[model samples]
Target: MRGNRVNPNKPSLYLPCETRNREFEAKLLLACHAAERGWRGVVGAKKAIDQRIARLPRGLYISKSITRRNRFILDIGKRLGHIVTAWDEEGLVFASPEIYRTTKVGATTLTIPEKLFAWGEANATAWRNHPAFNGTPISITGNPRADLLRPELRDYFADEARSLRRHHGDFILINTNFSLVNHFLPGKSLYRQMLQAKKQPISQYGSINGLALHKVKLFQHFIEMAQAVAQRFPWHKLIIRPHPSENLDTWRGIMAGHSNVAIIYSGNVAAWLLATRALIHNGCTTGVESFLLERPAIAYQPVVSEDYDSQLPNTLSLRVSDLNTLYMHIDNLLQGNTSGQETLLKKCHAHACQHIASFDGKSACERILDSLEPTKSLLLDRKKPPLVDQIIGWTAAESRRLFKRTQLVRRTTTDSTGYQQHIFPAVSQSQVETYLQRFSTLLNRFHDLQVDDLGDCIFALSKQ
Candidate 1:
């Protein structure tokens, strides 16, 4: 925690990303935006942040979530005199506000972040209504993730999207978000893990179990849908992209004999959505992204529950409850007959406007940077942690690191790094530089931003 005096010349922003495919590009865009404003943006894998927090320069740390585990990390950052702020990655799409509050946010975690960024007015209102809210400023600046779907930044994925189209021509992308029931690590259940972490009460067992059952039903339905699509349209490719946390082997095993189907879990989903003919999902975040991208999105819901289904994505999509209707919608969408799509998208746009910001105005990256302006001077003048506190914080971080390593070693379910790679495969310095260059070309900005490799899949973006 102990560090040298503040540089003052250029403030730093530490943006840690947990899942690479989901968060990396958006955070990188934010980092590039920060650098353009004369701030050094340190962006990297979340593990890198945890390992280097004690030694890194104190700055404003923008966390991806405020779960209890994240609260511990934020505690360390706070001890090190780093300003803390966060917006839950899972906050935008959920079954209900109450369930989200119970399962995703903690009262103690809420106390750690100095400020909270909300995806939209809905999330801001939800957080404000939470009993644990301590009057912290909540900015309804939207999420940078949403910024990627905006037309202005869609070219960021042009190369990847082109490659996808070249390789998997006219594919129907099926995105599944069922990690709660089917996790990458064997025997791992996100539901049980949440309960074990005290994120939910024992009283929530029934509700949580019901949600898990609902997802299982949806998962099975997706498999059936995939099979049906493969058989129905043998000429077209049926690509199944499971949630990053889901077991890939299970999918491969299930679709073993299907020659037309492929299970892929790589790259940012934006590219896939761009390349696909149509996106079929139940209630995934990507459905909303597809709609925003003006792509055809179909929500195949064989079973639905008011209490368990996510509202926004489903409502935003063209939903069909049966396989025949799903096939018909797919056929119509693929053949470019968007007969009912425009009206649906118009209504969905109005609906999405209530839940998402940054659809028509300045990008969320700019909005977030604007919100952070008032904190820059404070961050520049921030003092270092006292030696005693530094020692304690360092010791605690080391102990926790060792405990996690020991647990990883003891696990019999998967390889130590398998799940990590599945979520965020190692990123290279060249990849960061390439994307930064792409951003510069696409937006005619960020030309002065320089990248420095900080090891452990981390990089620093700053003005050269």
Candidate 2:
């Protein structure tokens, strides 16, 4: 979608898509809102973030993947005189060692972003004090994605949630976070590596490789827990929502012959959270989301340790250490007996409010836009890209697309019965407008800005 009457000379707001489309939808919705405020906005494909920045007028560009590996994008944005901000999409709960690894943190510290917007105080504090981001500016702006599930926007997904309930019926959501077994390398090889890495004696625990091995073992335990739940609750409907990075075929195989379980992967968690009887996970951000949505969240950690059990979700969610405890809690929730968890819910609310940023739903996005407002007049006007440069960009994009297609074809040929990939669906113009209209107050408050549909994911630009 595009903006109407956006002056070519005016500064623009550029948001790049992520590998997962829902992640990018957060930025797309923000772009729409920005357009309504008389700010020029552009949503670029993930692969063409650099190309879009190079061709467009200098403005603010927000990207989720501004790691040291892709620091070249930071350099390009700098050379072009654009303000680039890197926000963490994964949040703080699952802090990857890569963030602190010398390869990633050391190289991009100075060039990445002038400021990094974190999920909350906890995340902001962690990133600020990290050896990698020692001197970087970090703000505790609640993630915009979480805003989609806030109370103010609860009605936004009401229809979708109702539809999901009608189709899937009342069910408990089992959100999985075992990407190592279900997403990354071949499951057999990955499992072998995990076993090998875990063979180190207890003294080696917490080491770089040990940390990963611990994670892999956790994934294995998570799957076993799921199996136990399925067996114990044969009458109840269980909806297993695998991580977007997961392979669904593995889940399908695990759930085979279990008519009581269904596997789903796409769509926002808010709808699913709203529809479910309870949200069950080990160490996932969905529990935080479920807490915000006023849903019962149970963190099942059958195999726990200090290094792994200390996640924010584990702290906020009701702790269920064994299959029996999980079943008891889930059964109580299904039977409408939540009086016992009052203290736990209160703690979750307090922690959420303190660390998850804005619960009102509007502040996070507004704060982001407010930060970029000052840059409107500071943009440097440059001549459009030469035809040769444009040609090269287009050629490069096409080549990457072809290469990905070839890889997909090869994978399908090699293992036709393997796990099928589910792509995140795109948000249509109608969907964007529907959600944008929910912010009527913001739209009316900024009547000078207007948005229009520009096909091909590029929009026209103008101010007033």
Candidate 3:
């Protein structure tokens, strides 16, 4: 019986019962098993990757090499099993076992600069080639978060409005933007305290962007701009919803002098746009969201960053940095000179949006309805159990393989070994180390600073 023999009563099969019925997921389960086996390493590394994959927010995983996340990706797939599919250009590895065009999914802007995405895609070849990834381009559908724009979800928006009605006879909602500097700063804190600061990069080499450094100056600029708006206009109510990931105290401190400003932290962008008549942003993605809803938007600080210039929907930007110009632009928008900007913004909105999110705000809700169809059951039809041991082994192997490859690459490369005498760069390694040391001491004071998430790093900063 052991020598390639099968008992007629129960035959050995490649796939599990679920895969044939579900489509491709059985294969995924096996792949996940393989990955778990493959991720052999010091307990810390495996644990970290495992936790990160599980902790990442629900919605599409938007990495070009999403598969490269390897075990991490598989873990998410397995945990959220049947609820989500691994999306990529091809229907190969981690492809949804059930294929339904109607199932709603949530999506965030998956853009990662073509250069970065391409590099990641090339680096993880094994994950890229998995059978589930064979579909060249699959529609993962629209963002579930956008459901806030739907009439059903608009109640949340209405409540926000009612809160506004009680506070002031008239109000304005100014959505924030993605000025790289502003994105990094805590709005509540910067407004409270005016400070000039610079943070040493985390890595001397490869630290273009990953959320380090405080955006104090930019927030100061924004606070000043907002104050100018209130002083210039007789507006009574103003709700300043900084980005969700901001420190509210910073914004509150800035507005401390004036009692007129209110703060609202919302998880939904579309709902906020609908509740307001006009949108104000310094070229944030919310500008695009606002445009999709046909709301008038004001984009300021036209030259300082890339926000105002992209194909995102934006009514009229001040197009200049002068305070007077900004006031005039705000005045014109409040007075309804919105068409000039609206037409252009609509074009940008339409162009930018059509390619990425083809569905409206109800995309996620609508997508969820398709779970019942047999032909498109997500991954159910695969009728196969994946080779769990192989996948786990592969994951472990890849991790070690990558570490070794990195070590090998580092050994081969030298950064000007012969030129030992040169002027010290303005931003020095020692400076950063000193800064990090101070931060570590700061982080040690907090009980929760133990976690390694981005917020944990910030918590660690507060102690300093």
In candidate 1, the residue pairs with backbone N, CA or C atoms under 3 Å apart (3 or more residues apart, or in different chains) clash, namely none
TM-score of 3: 0.48
Q: Is candidate 1 or candidate 3 better by lDDT?
A: 1
Best by TM-score: 1
- Per-residue CA lDDT of candidate 1, range 342-370, in tens? 77777767678778877778788889999
Better of 2 and 3 by TM-score: 2
How does residue 408 of candidate 1 score in lDDT? 52
lDDT of each: 0.83, 0.64, 0.37
lDDT of 3 by residue, 1-464 (tens): 00121122211111111111111211222212222222100111222223343332222222212323343434433433212233332211111212111011111111111111111122123223434334332333433333333343344345555655565544567765323333223332322232234444334212222121223334556787777666666455667877643445656777766667776654345545655545566645566555545566666653453321332333223244667876665566666676756666555644544433423443432342232123222223334235574355356545644554444333222112111011111222233233233323432422211111122111001110
TM-score of candidate 1 versus the correct structure, residues matched by position = 0.93
Alpha carbon lDDT at 421, candidate 1? 66
Off by over 4 Å in 1: 1-8, 190-201, 204-206, 385-388, 407-415
Worst 10 residues of 3 by lDDT: 455-464
